[model samples]
Target: MSQISKVVLKDVDGNVLHPQTDAGIVSVNDAAGSPSNVQSEIQALREKQSEMANIDFFVNKGDVNSDADLPAQDYKNGWAYY
Candidate 1:
């Protein structure tokens, strides 16, 4: 099932046929209305995640944007782990 808040009718050249002046086209030329090959995408993402290290904690605390050396010898703007 699909849900639509609004519908637009465009001509072959992609001009809006009956555009409401107050309304606007905010999308990019090549943007997709929905995702394609969803199952394949999900499986690929899961496989990628499984290969990554599960670092669940970090000890360093400092301004990450600074060029100064971080607290730990290895903490180089490394995020608080997921």
Candidate 2:
């Protein structure tokens, strides 16, 4: 079996995040945390966050057949169309 090189990662404050070993006894692999893996993770998170940012809970409930910009109707019953 091939041995993977392991190291402890630290934050900006020098606090240890990941260690060379998982439980101080069992071996832990950090190969999945390569730069390319990190970049892809960041990209996936950004895309998911972007989709989350577009969640207009109010405007999303409007009917597709209406001009959703009526000015003075109380929309408590349903969507007001212009």
Candidate 3:
């Protein structure tokens, strides 16, 4: 396993806010916070991931210059016209 040598806390002006300190008993594999809190966040994102991925939206080619600029509607018609 890899080890973190140092962690620097810096400010907006690139000034050292706190002195370097050893990371005591830190686990890289452990959850950031409480298990329940992490699980809830993961579940919420998983539920929305599929719904967001399957969203249907229109594809704007450009402004219609003339009658020929518009696409033919006789083919398979949907939000995406390409």
TM-score of 3: 0.32
| Residue pairs that clash (backbone atoms under 3 angstroms), model 2 | none
Q: Which residue pairs in candidate 1 collide?
A: none
Clashing pairs in 3: none
Candidate 2: give its CA RMSD in angstroms.
11.1
Cα lDDT tens digits for candidate 3, 1-82: 3233455657999998777643432223324554343334444566788788897655545456654466565434443423
lDDT of each: 0.47, 0.50, 0.52
Alpha-carbon shift of residue 80 in model 2 (angstroms): 13
Candidate 3, run of 10 with poorest lDDT: 21-30
What's the true lDDT of residue 65 in model 2? Answer: 40
User: lDDT tens string, model 1, 2-76?
Assistant: 222344668899999866421123332222444334333444456668777575446446455547554465544
State the displacement of the C-alpha of residue 29, model 1, in Å, after optimal TM-score superposition: 15
Instruction: Give candidate 1 misplaced runs (Cα > 4 Å).
Output: 1-36, 54-75, 78-82
Q: TM-score winner among the candidates?
A: 3
| Better candidate by TM-score, 1 or 3 | 3
lDDT score for residue 16 of model 1: 93
RMSD per model, one decimal:
11.7, 11.1, 10.3
Whole-model alpha-carbon lDDT for candidate 2: 0.50
State which candidate, 1 or 2, has the greater lDDT.
2
